[model samples]
Target: MLGAELREARRRAGMKVGALLEVLGFSARWLSKLESGHRQTDARNVARLLGAYHVDSETFKRVMDLCRDVDGGYLIQGHGVGGADEVSAVRRHEAAARQLFSYEAVGVPALVQSEDYMRELFGRSVHLSADEVERCVAARKARQKVLNVGVPVKRTFVVRELTLRHLSGDREVAWGQLMHLFWLGNTRKVDVRVVGQDASFGYWDLYSFTLMRSPQFRPVVHIGATPYSLLFDEPRDTGFYEESARLLLANAMGVEESRAFIAHLAEHVGESVSA
Candidate 1:
């Protein structure tokens, strides 16, 4: 998380990594490893870098706090519960992002999931009580607020067609979520597409990931793991996810076709429930 902030500070300072290295008199390889979280920098080095970048005191404190939280580790992992440091880190990135790209294979993307769908999702957690489920749902809704802020988040989503077919046991919930996706797709803020089962990238069904981009920071990718979500800011990791998104988009249905497809599915689900 500190590395992500450092990269953001460098970008905000209008200094490329190479240029920053020249200014700091550090080797490119050293800076590279530091920024990618492969090598930990001492507090003195961090102070020097912050001074070089002219970062504000408040931001400096926040970055330092994050550094301590991670124990100099690069990855932040936490359960989906609210108020955890990992959750806070993810929220910070989400709030900062100007653009969000997401791919989901088995479930709906959180940004557009309906309240009913979300509630059902959280309710399924064996360990969560009714109140805990509500809290988690509330936290998720708060995350979606980024989409509606003054300058709304620009979003692109690629979902597997199978995701449309698999209902979370409630036809109304499934219909509501699909209609929500369809509605959002028609809006200017989001572009939603679906990849058919026969698409070239069928293997993408194995995982779900999100990439968030902001003018102030380097792109960050979040991969959902079993017990925790893994956050990656390293160029190699982010690049791999970016390329994966590109490949998925290449084979996904076009915006209009995807909207039509979602509408068709929602209608089918509605009819099924009526029948």
Candidate 2:
């Protein structure tokens, strides 16, 4: 508990190995092992490390509690095809999550990509080089494998009408993606919703967003815009985000109605309909 906090605090304070060792009265290698979690720490050593890092008693106790809780909170982060750093962080979180929720407006959640759809979309994008686009699409498809048949994770997706109309590549690709959503709606593992544009709710207009729910780390919020991807953890700020999410679900079309909407869209795009 103390060791992890101590290591991060030392790094933040810009303390070198020799300086940290001299200040803590421990050998450099010993401190390194402790910091790395290779050695079990006792209460006395925990107190010493806390003192070395100048961590207040209340904060130190909070850190200790966090270390002890195996199932703490969710780890949320920003992610997408255009947001690589955000994508990588989300990939890690998705692998660890037991349940996932997303709210989207513009682009599709890369977490549910089909290889064909990705290729088609990327093929049409001028912003990305062929190689870069291929890698991005492939990574997204790989991430989607977690939602494949027999996978235990539960996924819920909420999308608005504007996002549904925003096509990538061509009408064919857009229709295929819509069909895929319909199929997923029928599946037992997914809960799909479509929020109508006219369905008024007391929530801010967001570009797109994702929320990962787990019984383990603090909830993570990730947002992206062009070249910037931001991660947020302040609960007060996220309070509205959560509230908006609930309102979206409240105002969104139910599973059956959403499936019907997808079916209607597929027919509009001239696709052979199963949904």
Candidate 3:
């Protein structure tokens, strides 16, 4: 937890290791060791770090607590959270995060599916073997564990009409995914919206993005990709994405509208008939 929060805070503040050490009057090696989890955090160092980051008292206290928890191995720090490791980490973070937001500017279905669904779509040309597809599905399934965990995360989702229209699957698979979204939107697990095709300029023009917030860190956006995803820790960068996300929500269809849209699409695959 300490390592994650520190990395995010530093990135958000746009402070590199050397620069951060200069501001805190600490050695570069010390900060490096701390972040690497090779050295236990001390109060004096924690105070220096909090002051260097200009965090207020309340935020600083939370940061300190996270650090302590990380050092004691109580927080179950997750490593390599992108690509193949994303499945478990996504679940853990979603379950642990206080707030979870997603911007489905594009490729939204990729983030919400089982391996079999993907293989049925991309396997013929992409050549993903059964084992690889299973691995990917396992990871995706792990992420859904967040829905049943204690103190479930508050989830908000903004999707574009293009995402639904450009879905990569057969009629049934596409319909199933849309139905899943429809169900989630109606349930308490998420707040869902769809950006209309005719809407004016908005935040979701950047393809796709996701945001995760916790008590220890302000917020971080993860940019998704076909090959992998990257984390945006800089506050300035994240702030821009946040503004775009807000605009997306503003220009999107309300929950009821999105639900209706999903139902209409699901009917094509005969999913609504059973629903």
Candidate 4:
């Protein structure tokens, strides 16, 4: 956790690893190992890094505390989610967030995915067993409840048009997921948009990210890629993602247009199955 925090701080500070090494008089490999959590740094070194990043005192203390906890072999227990460390962290952030903004290059957002869609996704994981996949799907379903609890979380999703057209093996599952997106998009606190494949402003590469913000803490950005995931809380890092989201939204269709697009896809899928 401390390593991840440090990495985010460096990025937020707009300092490249090489540039940081030049300032700190450290080897590139050493910095790499430190950021990757392969090696540990003492408090004085941590303080110096934080100083370089211009982190506020309170945030500095919080990060130092996390470093201490990790050094003392502390472990965070998941809420029966059975996910990796990154997944657990993302869930915790989600629970705390009053607002969430997410972008997906392909497939549906996890929060709105149908059970069958989730099952299909989990099933594709080569290492997971049937039982493990079932457990994960159940856990995801439980996590979705946060959207409807007390005061619903305000969410904005920007998904690519290609994602809407992609179908899972089960046509019913794909159709159901699209309908679920449609319902959620029409909800008072939820906004869903879609970026067309031909959008000139869209990124050339596929990327998925989520930004979560809460009243109690700084905003966090979560990037989930296969085999690796990252959670960033640094202001600069989170701000960068927020900017990226803004760009994506600028190119994306409006909520109503996105809804219409999803409905059309679902209708097409339903008709094809009927045929």
Off by over 4 Å in 3: 5-92, 109-111, 114-116, 121-127, 202-204, 226-228, 271-275
lDDT of 4 by residue, 33-87 (tens): 6765557788889888998889888878877876665543222323333463225
- Superposition-based RMSD of candidate 1 using all C-alpha atoms, in angstroms: 5.2
How many clashing residue pairs are found in candidate 4? 0
Q: For each candidate, C-alpha RMSD in Å?
A: 5.2, 10.5, 10.5, 10.9
- Whole-structure CA lDDT of model 2: 0.65
Q: State the lDDT of candidate 3 residue by residue for 169-259, as single tens digits.
A: 7666677677777777776567777777898963346657677777654465665554544553456666887787777777888878888
Off by over 4 Å in 2: 1-82, 149-152, 271-275
**lDDT (Cα atoms) of all candidates against the true structure:** 0.78, 0.65, 0.63, 0.74
Q: What C-alpha lDDT, on a 0 to 100 scale, does residue 115 get in candidate 4? A: 82
Candidate 1 local lDDT, 1-275, one digit each (tens) = 66667877887888776777778899987776676556777777888888888889997887776666565244656575653223767866777778889887778888778789989987888888998888988888887776777776778988889888896858988988898898887765899989987887545446788889876557888776657767767686687788888788889999999999999999999998799
Highest TM-score against the true fold, candidate: 1
Model 2 over residues 49-88: C-alpha lDDT tens digits? 6667777678678556534431222223334554543354
Of candidates 3 and 2, the better by lDDT: 2
lDDT of 4: 0.74
TM-score of every candidate relative to the true structure: 0.77, 0.64, 0.64, 0.69
Q: Model 3's lDDT to the true fold?
A: 0.63
- Which residue pairs in candidate 1 collide? none
Clashing pairs in 4: none
